[model samples]
Target chain A: MIELKDVYFSYPSGAVLEGIDLTVKKGEYVGIMGHNGSGKTTLARLITGLLLPGKGYVRVNKIFTTDSERLLDIRRSTGMVFQDPDAQAIGETVEEDMVFGLENLGLPVPEIDTRIEKYLDLLGIRELRHRNIRTLSGGQKQLVNLAAVMVMEPECIILDEPVSMVDARCRKMILQHIARLNHEGTAIVHITHDPEELIRCHRLIVLSRCRVTNQGTPHEVFGQLLDEKKMDVPAPYAISRKLGLSPVLTIKALLEELCRSRSGN
Target chain B: MSIEIRQLTHIYDASTPWETIALDRIDLTISKGTVFGLVGGIGSGKSTLASLMAGLGTPAHGSITIDGEPPDPGRNVGILFQQPEDFFFEKTLFEDMASGLLHLGLTEEEVHKRIHSTLDLLGLDHQILDRSPFHLNRGTLRLAAFATVLTMRPGYLILDEPTASLDPKSRKRLVEVIKRISGDIAIIYISHRLQEVVAVSEYLAVLEQGKVAFTGTVPGYLDWATGQDAWEYLPVLNQVMYGLQRLGFDVDLNVACLEDAVEQIRLSLERT
Candidate 1:
């Protein structure tokens, strides 16, 4: 389980996250959403240990997130995929990048090979295994980034704005991959401003000034953001939310409802 | 002012073996004082087209014209990028709004007056004038970016994903602003959501595989969209409403908004 207790984060200017408390059971597919500058990214960093809380504690599985001896374990256990794919890549080629962390881990050659093969196929980037970084499109770059992290085999993945900058088709592809990961019992915490992305998760956590303002299933959080007329919630879902219906999150769900209603009639 | 492009193409990393085509032979036109929308899936060259319109990128093999002249950066074009705050480094909102006008040699007084009026137009109050640009919320920053652009008073305004990540009310306000201000300038709205484009656009273009796959009046593009698989990504409201038609449900085949669809359903029941 992951836990945050009375967490507060303050920058030099002002308090961003204040008096926040939350807990996530292992294998929970959680999503965090809010307007830009809402400190969604700050919360992600805090969980990843990229940034520390000014006050309070962040712990994973009963281990303190800030311990230096436990830091490596935290890093290994929690992987993050940021919005920009270009900023994340340090390898010249896709394959080399996927194995970069494994090589540093000093794993056995066979074990490293096994991990690399597993992630390459998992992210559907096997063809781009030897492709140059700069030549790939934004979607391809994102896929490679996901593959690189998957090769590390972390227990939890935290994605920040994963679909915001990418195109629609690529967004769908990446979102589907995340859904598949959650289904396989690997926890995913998607942090984004896109309403469509927010609705895909089983649960949502919303931050305002770095504090968790609302937390629950996507419907509940989206309900409040929307009742308050939050625009960042995917417009369609928010519109459905506005009209007082359990808005279908995907085309399949919408179609199923259409068919079922027709059959009922 | 209007925008016109013909045979426009862009090649990233030209003169290299690893070159990739971003735009290819794209032909488009935006009439004066009309909101023209560009929509497509990601990597559909929507942003590349926006760059060309904003003069941030050069078209490889095309003639581009905006307001009867070739597009030039820092000229008669004002752009609000997807992340508009990144482009701002001013200490205060007012200063940020005035920077471009000051660069253009406008008098300090003139810049100040325009900044004040534009800020009001965006619904931001005067107290925010002294507020740090970095400390503002996304909705405020999004509005501030528009305010800065309004200060320039460009003949053409290009907004890339202007409504993404905003709250519903903020989105509504932004859309209404676009509608109200579009008649004063040629508006180029680039986005992946076709529903939004359908709502505000007089004309529409869908870029696919670096080419302008469809371009015409909103109705014409809607017609094309209705016939293509591209409609699959439309909002669930549109899909459910349209799906009712496909399944022979009692309703018009194309209800984009839920309120209208609900009313239609009510009326249908009344007639029954």
Candidate 2:
């Protein structure tokens, strides 16, 4: 659903991304990870058409992102969640924020209301509908941001460190919702620094020093890409490896392996 | 300096429609040279408590004392806000660091000397003094902000989600620096990342709905939180160990880091 073709992007200071070629098929969950200044956010902006590539192109839903005529279509197909929750919000109330994008699209009032209610319930934030956005905590505001984007029913969602501000409880809730949405065939591109969040992603892409250095499944990437690149491995994965066992990303998987081995499986 | 808070209650926009009882009759204390971790979900009064302790705002009820005197936010506490930019407004790092020092009646030479020494303490290069605070990367900005705070040398330091939005390398570096200096200053670390909290903090407090839900050492809180419904608040290592405990594997939930967890798991398996 999303593709980047030999893309090169730069700012006034320096080139950020170079020789990028990638694609995300329908319903694919792609985890993009790299350290700060690794051009990860720039890639997200490029795919969402927020920033045009300096050279080459980015396409969403087979439509060139640079095409002004199809700008609305591009935006409708891909929703981008930014890193900072406070900066991205424009609405005074939670419900208002959820409907902001739809109202901008000039959808019917009843349809917008229906969508707002549906998504808020889906995210378990229905009770926070009328509350002032400023009063909500960082995690709640982020959940509202997610509801705002998902209410529009985009084909693909690009989340840029959505859970970084949230507490562990709310982060899990948000990730579970993202996983469910992806399972329902909406493509997901999650940009983050945490390895725990990366396990659910079907494919992993690592960018470094303005280039794509690694791309593979979670296991493949964790097996060597993380260590070889000096990337941060999740604590569970690192601990399992330290104990001379095959490292598993998730806690549930690790527990299963431990039980199996202890029971002489 | 030690801090003692008793019957603390804070209400934002009180007696109005926007009224929020951010904190309710909370009592706490932070001794010198120890890391006190304040953890809670969003809107659970964590920031309110931090602000109150930092003297950013006045508590509507109760009392706060620093070494048997009323706490002074300006003189006794240094708070690194959730956003680095919140604590900075100058055009350059040098000016920002100087702004805080100028108020202390220090001469230019003295201010520069203090800033340089503070930067050295935080392991920041003096070259960054020429750059704009807005232009630096997140990690550098964080360290720059740290230098600004350390220039004051407040007895109490309040850090709100210090590692959020930071890369692993930056996070590790910041944690190491905090560890290096933790013996001298009392640190009140507020974060949802329980692993980092466990690693840095010697004491713990879990806030729930504007109340102190649990308080104790890392291991004590882990045992208490594991049986509670707030499973997400548990650190990744503890969560995995809790799962192992559920599966009938006698595992210790107190392992703080990956290395500790590895040792614990090895010993558990060998015993099995």
Candidate 3:
């Protein structure tokens, strides 16, 4: 639902993104991976219309980001979770922050309440509903941010390193929730540095020095990146590749592959 | 010398309906020249404990002492908070790095030397010192914040989620810097990245509900974690190792590195 054609963006300091071309179809789970200062965040902002492209154009659901009259429609169709949780929190309490967005959307109070409860429970933060957003831990605050975004129920959600602040268990839970949302036809643009988190993504795009250096399925991109020693592959996939077996993404898949190979032998 | 924490309890919004125990009677010891990893689920008190240890505030019902005295953040204890770069108020990075050192009565030459040396240790060039800290990239800003802490020459360092938003290369560089410095100073390396914790820490402590759930060597914690079936909290290699063990293959569960884990799996597969 999001498309960027010949995108060029620059700040007063220097150019951040140059001649970038990308597209995210409806319900597509696209992962954007890159090193720091690679304009990944800039690209996200470009798609969300927070920062307009200096050259070329960005369109969400056929509405150009430059179209000020339709900017609200673009925002309603897409949601973005920032990397820093504290930056996104506006309300004093978790429930208040969640309701603020729904209220802005002018949804009915009953519907807003239902959405607030549903997302808090879905993210396992129901107990934190009344907690001051500032008092919560970094991980907790990040979950609240995700919940706030998901409560919007936008057509697509762009998450910027959503799981980086969370512990392993919480990371898995958040990823599962994101996957579930994507399964139900919500587009996902997951920006992260962790390769393992991209294992289940339908497509992977690697950004480097203001360019899309690589793009393909996770396996193809990771395999090529690993071969070129350009990126760090997840341990399971790396190990499986080193052993002359087809690379698998998750530990469970790696284990199954190992066992099946042994049985074949 | 070692830092000792006993019966430490910290509560937020105490005496009110919103009062909550962030850390509950936590006790631990961190010796010099060791990397002690603190890990937990969300709101498990890792950051609270780190702040208490860093002397950010006093605990409610217990004590934290570094060599028989309260932690002195000025000289002997340094903390790199989650958003450490926010603490950079000086116009230039050099001024920021020198701010803490100047309070120690060090000569200007020594302060500059320390700042330069710290930057060198982190593989940063001296040319950036004149630039505004706000102008640097996220990775550089993180390293600059880290440099500010190290320039003080603290005996104990507390890093809270140091690699949270860092890329893989930056994460590796930071880990290397930690290893190079852990020989001279004790470090409380707190993070949710289990694999990184396992790689860098000699000891591990798991917290749950503000209580210390497990604390021991990294290998011991790994075995304990596997037994507890907290596989979700394990590194990918460890999870694979645990999975292999369940599939009736004899593999080393404590294999932390990828090369070692691969070797262990290869030998186990050959034997089976």
The residue-by-residue lDDT of candidate 3 on B56-131, one tens digit each, is 8878999999988898886779999996777887888888888778888999999988888888899998998998
lDDT of 1 by residue, A1-265 (tens): 6788999887765787888887777788888777666777778888888888888999977778888788888888888887657768988988788778888878888999888888778666676777678656555677788888877878899887776555656667778888888888888888776667766688888776566778888767766766775445554564444444457565556556545544554
Q: What's the candidate order when arranged by decreasing DockQ?
A: 3, 2, 1
Clashing pairs in 3: none
Model 3, docking class: medium
Off by over 4 Å in 1: A35-37, A83-148, A198-200, A206-214, A218-251, A254-265, B253-256, B268-272
Tens-digit lDDT string for candidate 2 (B133-204): 766777788888877888888888999888888889989989988898989989999988888998899998
Q: What is the C-alpha lDDT of each candidate?
A: 0.75, 0.85, 0.91
Q: Where does candidate 2 stray beyond 4 Å?
A: A226-229, A244-247, B13-19, B69-71, B85-90, B103-105, B227-230
| CA displacement after TM-score superposition, residue B211 of candidate 3 (Å) | 0.4
Candidate 3 chain A minimal-lDDT segment of 10 residues: A227-236
Model 3 local distance difference test score: 0.91
lDDT at B127, model 1 = 85
RMSD of 1: 3.6
